[model samples]
Target: MAGIYLHIPFCKQACYYCDFHFSTSFKYKRELVDALVKEIHLQKNYLQGETIETIYFGGGTPSVLDESELNRLLAAIHANHTVASNAEITLEANPDDLDKAKVNALRKTDINRFSIGIQSFFDDDLLWMNRVHRGDEAESSVKRAQDAGFENITIDLIYGYPLLTDAKWKSNLNKAFELQVPHVSAYSMTVEPKTALASFISKKVYPPLNEQQSASQFMQLTDAMREKGFEHYEISNFCKPGHYSRHNTNYWRGVKYIGIGPSAHAYNGFTRQWNIPNNARYMQSVQQNIIPAEVEELTEENRLNEYIMTSLRTIWGLDLDRLNAIAGGSAPLLLKAARHHFDKGWISQHEKIIYLTQTGKLYADAIASDLFF
Candidate 1:
């Protein structure tokens, strides 16, 4: 089975730290939606007839689209592909956009799950991030969704920023627990180049991020989630039993998926491709029944490295047997490369299955790269 991700590349306003492709103008909103529907039809054969088990509406903010727009896109998919009867359909939303009326409107659609962007429950922090929603709205949005009988919910939280003190971080986690969200995805604040936050730090207008503080907060998060009976399933994701994000889990497992929209990406085991990031250009190309995208055929090394990077970050450790199946005689070289980490007690091997120790997760990316063939 495969998955489908629709990238809605429109936002009400830009977050200070976000660098994802998006436009604040609604000048081409109707045109863009039309193009997205067409792209769904055009990319119908991309997944090669794998049953779509998950459909995710991710973006700048999928909540920006109204009921008809969303349904039109979903209808296009239903017409073009074979979707699973019990497929997990997710919509990523900003808190401010999920008011009572909006929540009720969403209930009319097939969106069974929500991934709310509640970066913080602190009004000051929200302002610092240039987020349009206030702290109060974040809490209310989740409650509204629940009140409307949508229980499959997850929230996104940010940590390690200058304004997020350890005490505040703890409070944030406590609030999330109080909200009773089934899954939580928290990320450390990284000031990507060309974002507003990066410029502020470069100009000395804002203090630089503190790694020590980030590590402390991350530990705090893990400990709190574990105490609350949540499973730390991935490096930055925690969930209650059987409540993981199906779409993201499939991605980590290297399942095939087709991404529909400008700036979206798709992978089908052997090759990966991404749509053009420009709104006008994408719409124009789709008008001519063309998918303006670049493709890359995976080399053996690329496939191995991709597996190593994605698998090592999950509760499912890198499978040595699978590695050998990918390329015979590859496991011995990987084991040799992982020897130093084992000595450092950062990883442990049991019956040929390797798992990251709590300490190893702190340097997951670095360690994965080290073990890459």
Candidate 2:
């Protein structure tokens, strides 16, 4: 089974800290959707007939697309590919877009999951981040989605913002737990260069993030989540039993997936490709029956690094047995390098599986790289 991802490149407003490929103007919205539909047909065979088990509608804000447009895109995908009957279709939505009517409209489709972007539950944090939705709207949106019959819902939360105190961070997690939200994806706020947040900090318009505070909040999050009986299945994701995100899990497990739309990526377990980031250029190229993408053939080292990067972040640690076959018997070299961390109690090996300890998860990337052969 495989997956499909469609990037909607239109947003009503540019959040202060966002650096994703998007345009605030919807001048070419119709044209872009048409191009995306064509791209779907053009790339149908990319996954090589693997049953599509997941379909993800990701940013700039899939919620910005109307129900009719979304339906058209879904129809195009179904017409071209052999989608599984019980595929886990997800749409990444923002809080401002979820009204009773819109949520009801979404329920008419095959989308079984909703990943709402509710970055924070405080008004100050939302304002500082220039988010379009207010705190109350965030809560209301989730309520509406639930009322609309979306049982498999996930929310995105951000912590470590300069505006968030330790108490506020805990409150955010506590609110999600109160809501009985089965899945949650949280991220530490980081200022990317060229983002508005970076510019603001450079000019003293906004306070900079505190790394120590961020680390403390992450520890608080992990502990609170454990107490609430949520599984830290991935570094940034937690879920109740049986509520894990099948799409993202498939991604971390290294299943093949094709990503459509401008600036989206595709992987086939061998090579990776990404479309050009420019929307105008992408539409123009696809208009001429060409796919505007750059491809890279994966080398052994590249594949190993990728496996280390993704697998180490998940509850399923690196499988030494599978690594031996994929790495052509050089897997022991990787395991040998991991002994230092094992001795330090940062990671443990049991039944040939290597997993990061709670202490090790804080430095997950660093530990994974150290074990890279």
Candidate 3:
């Protein structure tokens, strides 16, 4: 089964730490949405007749679009593709965009899941991040959605910033737990180059994120969630049993997906393509019957490295038999290089499968790199 991802590239306000492509203006939103619809039709044949099992409406802020606007996009998708009856459809939202009326209206749509950008339930954290929503509104939004009969919900949290004390971090985790949110996506704050936070650090207006703080908080987060019976199913995502983000899991497992809108990416096992990142250019190109994207056909080495990178970050771990299929010598070399890590108890191997231990997950990216051919 395949998936579809739509990147809504407009945000009402920009967060200080974001590097994703977006426009803070709605001047061209309607036109861009139309371009996205057109792009969907143009790329409908990319996945070779695979049934869409997941449809993820992700972006600068998917909730920024209203009921009619969202309905139009969903209608376009249904008209062009064969979608599963119970496909997992997710919309990435913000706390400020969700209210009782909005939540009720959303429940009437085809979107069955929500990944709300709560970030933090603390006023100080929100201010530091320059987020538009406040602490009370964050808590209210979750409950409001739950009360509106939208139970399949997830919330995002950030840690390791200078102002986030250990106590505050602990409080943030407990708040999500108390609210009984089924899925939690907690990420350590890493300053991306060219973002506002990066400039702040460069100008000495803000301190840089400490690696130790991030590592410690991650350990804290994993322990707390596991204690509450939430599974650390992915590197940054934890969830109650049977509530994983099917859309993301599908991507990590290398299922083909087509991405629509500016700066969106698509993969079909052998090649990857990304649309142009400019809104106006994207619209013009779509109007002129062009995709305006770059494509790269994956080499054998690229496929192996890609598989190792994504699979190593999840609970499923790396499959040795598949590695052997890709290259007969790869599994043996990987096993030999990994022997020391197992000796150090940083990783565990059961038969042909290998997964990072809690301690090792902190350095998952680096370890996956080491294991790459």
Candidate 4:
């Protein structure tokens, strides 16, 4: 089954650390949504009529769209595609947008999953990040969504901000565990170039993220979640039994997906295409019956590298047999080089399947690079 991803490229305000392709301007909202609908129709055949098992409304903050707009987009998608009856439809929401009315509206739809951004559930941390939502709003959002019958909820959390103490990090994790959220995706704060946080660091206005604090907080998270019987299925993801994010899992498993709207990407095993990042240009192009996007045909080496990069990041790891199949038996030397990692106890191999050990997980990206053709 394939997946579909829609990128809504508008946010209420910019987070200090955000580098995502979003603008705080709502001037282009209606046009952008219309363009997204048109793009959906334009790209309907991209996945080759595969049953779409996952539909993700990711962002800029998908919850930013009002109810009617979201319904229109979803209706357009259903009208154009063969969506599965029980597809895992996910909406990426921010805490401030999860009010009673929005939650009710979402519950009325087929959107069965939510990935709420509750980056740090402390007032100080939220202020540090310049997030519009407060600590109370963050907690209330989850409770409100649950009250509105959204049980398949996951949340995003950030750890190790300079303003976030270890105690606060533990509190954040404990809140999720206490609330019995089925899935959690956590990340260590990394300053990206051109972001406000980057500028602040460059000017020594704010202290840098404490790497040691982040590492310790990560270990604390893993241990805490494990104790709560949550499976550390992927490096940054934890889930209760059978509650993994299907859309994200499909991406990790290298399933074909079509991404819609500005700055979105689509892949179908051989070629990858991305829409132009400019919202105004995207709307004009779609209005003129054009799909404003760039495409690239994957070379043999690029395909191998892509597989290595995505597959090695998950618990499934890399399967030599699968790699051979994807490569059509052309790159024996690539798999041959990985034998040393297996011999050195960095990776475990059972016939054609090779997975990382706890130690090897630390060096996963490097190992993948080494095995890349």
Candidate 5:
């Protein structure tokens, strides 16, 4: 089974630290949706007839689209793809966009999962992030989605920002459990170049992020979530049992997926492609039945490094047999390199499958790089 990811590139406003492709203006909204539908038809064969297991609507802000627009896109998908009857359909939504009427309308769609952006339930933190939703709305949004019968819900929380204290971070985790959200995707606040956060720090308008604070809070998050019976299934995700994100899991497992819309990416087990990040350019190309994108053929080394990078960050751990096949007899050398981390108690190997310990997870990126062939 494969997955389809649709990127919605419009937002009500820009978040302070966001560097994702998005337009805060609604000028090209209709044109962009039309382009997306056409692009779906154009790329229908990308998945090569694999049954679609998931359809994900990601963004700039997918929730910004109305019901009619969403239905039109979904209809196109059904017409062009073999979506499974029980396929998981997810829409990423912002709290302010999910009012009573909107949630009710959404329930009528095939979307069974809701990923809400509730970065924090504290007003100060919300302002720090410049999220469109207020603290009360963030809480009420989940309550509203639950009231609308969306049980397979996940909400995002941002930790390690200057405004988020340990107490506040714990409160955020507790709030997810309190609301009975089945899945939670939390992330650290990274200041990408050209983001407002980076700009602020460069001029001393905002305090620089503290690595120690981030590490401390991450440990706190894991401990607190475990107490509440949530599994840290991914390095940046926690969920109740049986509630892991199948869409993201497919990504980590190296499954093929087609990405539609501007700035979206697709991987077909070997070649990786991404659409132009600009809305106008994307629309122009799709209008003429051409997909404007760049493609890269994955070398054996590329695939091996990717497998190591993505697999090492999850609870499932990296599969040794698969790595051995791709390593071209260099697997032994790689394993030798991994022995130091194993001896350091940073990673554990169950004969072949290797998993990072809690301490190792802190240095997951570094560890993966070291193990790369």
Candidate 6:
């Protein structure tokens, strides 16, 4: 099965730490929506008639689109692709955008899941992050969605920022548990090079992120979620059984998917492509029936490294047999590279699978890179 991801590249305001491709202005919203629909038609054959089992509306903020706009995009997908009867359709939303009217409007569509951005339930922390919603709105939005009968709900939480103390982080987790959300995606705050957080740290306006604090909070999160019967399925994701995000799980398992919209990425088994990150250029090219994107043909090394990087982050361990299938004789070298980690008790083997220990997940990226060919 394949998946479809639509990137809505407009947000009402920019968060201080966000570096995703998005426009705070809506001057070209209609044009962009039209271009997205056109792109759907243009990329119809990209998935080669595979049944689309997951349709994800990710963003800058997908909730910004009204009913008509969202319907237009989904309508185009249904017309052009073979979607599954039980497809998981997810809409990424911000708390402030999910008012009563908006939630009721969404109930009219086929969106069976919601991924709400509720970074914190603290007004002071929200202000520090320059988020558009208040603490109260965050709680109320989820309740409103639940009242509207949307049960497949997930929320986003952030940790290890200057304004987020350990106590506050614990409160955030407790609040999430209290909400009875089926899924929770929590991420440590990292200062990307071009984001406001990075600039503030460089200028001494904000303190540098504490790696120790981040590590401690991650342990806290894992322990709490495990105690609450949530599966730590991925490094940054936890969910009640059978409630994982199908779209993102497909990504980790290397399923083929088509991405629509500016700065969105698509991957078939052999090649990967990403759309132009500019709004005007993407719309103009799509208007002319052209896909303004760059593509890369995968090499054997590329495939092996990609698998290593993505698979190691999940509860599913890296399959040594799969590694050797990608390129014969690759597993021995990888095992040699992983010896130090095994000696440190950071990794363990069960039959043909290599899984990260609890401590090893902290160094997952570095270990994967170290094992890369």
Q: What would the per-residue lDDT of candidate 1 be over residues 164-243, giving only the tens digit for each residue? A: 98899999999999999999999999999999999999999999999999888989999999999999999999999999
Candidate 3's residue-wise lDDT over 155-222, tens digit each? 99999899988999999999999999899999989899999999999999998789999999999999
Candidate 3's C-alpha runs over 4 A off are: none
lDDT of 6 at 120: 97
Worst 10 residues of 1 by lDDT: 346-355
In the range 1-373, model 2's lDDT, one tens digit per residue, is 9999999998989999999999999999999999999999999888999989999999899999888999999999999999999999999999999999899999888889999999998998999999999999999899999988898999999988888988999889888988889999999898999999999999999988887887888899999999999999999999999889999998898999999999999999889999999999999999998998999998887888788888889999888887876778767898789888988888988897888998888888889878776
Off by over 4 Å in 6: none
Tens digits of per-residue lDDT for model 5 on 238-274? 9999999999999999999999999999999879999
Per-residue lDDT over 1-373 for candidate 6, one digit per residue giving the tens place of the 0 to 100 score: 9999999999988898999999999998998999999999999988999999999999899999999999999999999998999999999999999999999999999999999999999999999899999999999999999999999999999998878888999899999999999999999998888998889889999889999999999999999999999999999999999999999999999999999999999999999999999999999999999988899999999999999999999999899999999999999999999999999998999999999999999999999989999
Q: State each model's CA lDDT, in order.
A: 0.94, 0.91, 0.92, 0.88, 0.92, 0.95
Error of 2 at 244 (Å): 0.8
Name the candidate, 2 or 4, with the larger TM-score value.
2
Candidates 4 and 6 compared by lDDT, better number: 6
Output the better candidate (1/5) by lDDT. 1
TM agreement with the true structure for every prediction = 0.99, 0.98, 0.98, 0.95, 0.99, 0.99
Q: Taking the tens digit of each residue's C-alpha lDDT, what string does model 4 give over 154-264? A: 999998788888888889998998888999999889899999999999899999888678768888898898899888878789999899889998988889999999899
Question: Which of candidates 5 and 6 reaches a greater lDDT?
Answer: 6
Clashes of each: 0, 0, 0, 0, 0, 0
Q: Candidate 5: which pairs clash?
A: none
